[model samples]
Target: MEKKKRFGVLLCADDSEYVKKKYGGYFQVFVGLLGEEGETWDLFRVVNGELPNDEDIDAYDGFVVTGSCSDAHGDDVWILDLVRLLRRLDSMRKKVLGICFGHQILSRALGGKTGRASKGWDIGVTCIHPSPSNKLLSSLCIPSHLLIIECHRDEVWEPPPHAEVLARSDRTGVEMFRYGEHMMGIQGHPEYTKDILVNLIDRLLRHKHIQTSQAEAAKASLKEKEPDREAWKRLCRSFLKGKSLS
Candidate 1:
């Protein structure tokens, strides 16, 4: 029998009661999107400073850095630790997929810059135009434009020197980017459903992170277009597993 692939999720966000009750936390959400039978998925709640041992790193087929409520540019202790860990992963050429804040942190780990989005907060379904110049896009058979759920105020201002911009949108310059074959960052939440976004929007409102008007507008956008979740799943799975695009 073939050996099972092992994956790790460096979960950055603390799960809210709603998410825990509904989806069993962000870890489960990601597993639902990327997990397959015969694969072992492990979770590391990095927000609380949980990480895999250094010697065990090689056991994982790939690692995923999840989105966080904290800013990627912040110099919090855990954030700094995460940066060091990411640097180690990069040096080893480990397959790493970063989402949202994860994307920004990965850029920072590679000596890139990250900050607030110049276009302000992008908090709804967005149409991402994958760069035609990227051979990987063509190989993955991804569509010209993919609709994805986005809820972020920060973005990667500059990717690493060797990185290629993979996708872009009107509001954000680096919607998606890749540094070599081992590292890729996506600004949207492919694992999220419309309902999860709705709940998050409510929480943001309760915490005054966004105004009611913005919340309403974001919710409205969701009704306007559905995310291309199936395509995203295939793209992520293939990239991490090294499956051919065909």
Candidate 2:
């Protein structure tokens, strides 16, 4: 039998040791980044554990960092370790993708900065445009007015010296970027399902991002709109196949 390609999924959040229910969080982002690549999903690291060391990376084809509740600017040791892991992945030319906090870490690791961004949270869906196309896009440029779910308070302020900005939104110009060749980061939660986002919005009720009523209203509206399965498949295929760019 042919060997199945393996990949790494690391979580930066502190998911209390025991999960009361089987649901989303880092797992959701992992599936989003992967989007049904193969029958058996290969996750290297569990949620809320120590980041893996250098030699550990050889076990996977690429790495996917999940969004964390912790801010990238904070002095968390684990956070720093993940950043180091990112650097190693980039140097090795392995595909690296970050979502939300994942996005901030990628930028900061590449000599950029992340903090209590001047831009506030983009809780609901927002339109994104591909500013600069790449080979992965499959020769079909999406409409400039595509709506994607956005949910990050800490935005990526800049891309590294050699990194290029791939997609942007009116709210935050650094919504998406490509570092080096295959490495990429997205501020928006492209992997988010409407149901999951709704639950997440409710989970973050304590935060002053969006009002409970507003989030609830948005959730109701989302039920009517269909999830962009094509976009999900395209991203997954492009990254796994190593043809990402456009």
Candidate 3:
């Protein structure tokens, strides 16, 4: 029998009540999107100061850093710790995939710059054009433009040294980037569904993070176009599983 592949999720956000009730927390949400038969998935609530031990790092075939409510540029202790962990992971060439805040944090760990976007928050469906110059990305067989669900105000101002920009949008310059073959960072939430974005928009409005007008516009945009979920899933799975994309 073949050995089971193990993956770890470094969850950086607290699950909303809606998500907890509907999806059984973010772990299940990620597992639902990325889990496969004969594979074991583990969760670590990094927001609550939980992380994988150094000795146990080798146990996981890959690691995913989930999106967070906190700013990646914040000077919080946990954020600093996560940065150190990422640096260690980079040195070992461990496969690490980052989303939203995770993406910014990963860039920071790898000597990149990140900050709030000048154009403000980008919520709802966004179309990203893949970089034709990236030969590795071309092998993925994805379309020239991919529609993905995005909910972020922070963006990667600059990618790390030796990192290649995978995709970009009109609002965000670095929508997706890759560092070597072992690490990738995505500014959008490909794992999210329309419903999740709706709930998040509502929450953002309630918290005054965004105005009602912005929320309404974002929600409206969703009705106009559906995300390319299957393609995003294929790309993520191929990258994480180290499979031939072609």
Candidate 4:
């Protein structure tokens, strides 16, 4: 019998009440998107300082770094530790997938720069244009442009020297990037549903992270279009599972 593939999620955020009740947390959301038959997934709440020991890193097929409310460029102790861990994973050539803040942190860990966005928060479904050189996406059934859920104030200013920018948007230059064959990063949340994004927008507004007008604008954008969730699922699963794009 073939062995089941094992995956780990390095969760970088605390679960909101809605996420906990609806999906059991962001970890479950990702597993729902990426997990398949004969696959097992686990979580490490890295935001809470829980991490898999370095010696045990080889146990999983790949690791996913989840989004965070914290700044990727912040000098927090746990953030520093996570950066070091990412560096170690890169050295091992382990497959690593990063989302949002995860994307920024991966860039930082790999000798890139990340900082506040010049245009302020992007808090809605935005279209991303994939690069022509991203041959891995050729096998997927998608259009020239893909819409994805985005809610971020920080952006990747520069990608690592060895990384290739895979996608870009009008608001952010590096929407997606690939490092070598084993590492990839996405600035948008492919795992999120429209309802989830709506809830997040409300939360942001309540916390004063964004103004009421901005929240209304973001919600209005959602009515105009929807994210290409199915295509994103296929693309992300193909990358994580080592499946050929062709």
- Give the Å error, residue 231, model 4: 0.8
Which one is best on lDDT?
1
Query: How many clashing pairs in candidate 4?
Result: 0
lDDT per residue for candidate 2 within 47-134, as digits (tens), equals 3455656676776677777777788777677777777778888788887877788888889888887776676666777767766346
Question: Model 1: how far is 199 from its true place, Å?
Answer: 0.5
RMSD per model, one decimal:
1.5, 3.2, 1.4, 1.3
List the global CA lDDT of all models.
Answer: 0.92, 0.69, 0.91, 0.92
Off by over 4 Å in 2: 15-25, 32-40, 44-47, 138-141, 206-227, 244-246
Q: How does each model score on TM-score?
A: 0.97, 0.84, 0.97, 0.97
| lDDT score of residue 158 within candidate 4 | 92
Question: Which lDDT tens digits does candidate 1 get at residues 27-133?
Answer: 99999999999899999999999998999999988999999999999999999999999999999988899999999999999999999999888999999999887
**Model 4 RMSD, rounded to 1 decimal:** 1.3
In candidate 4, position 206 carries an lDDT of 94
lDDT score, candidate 1: 0.92
Candidate 3, position 150, lDDT: 97
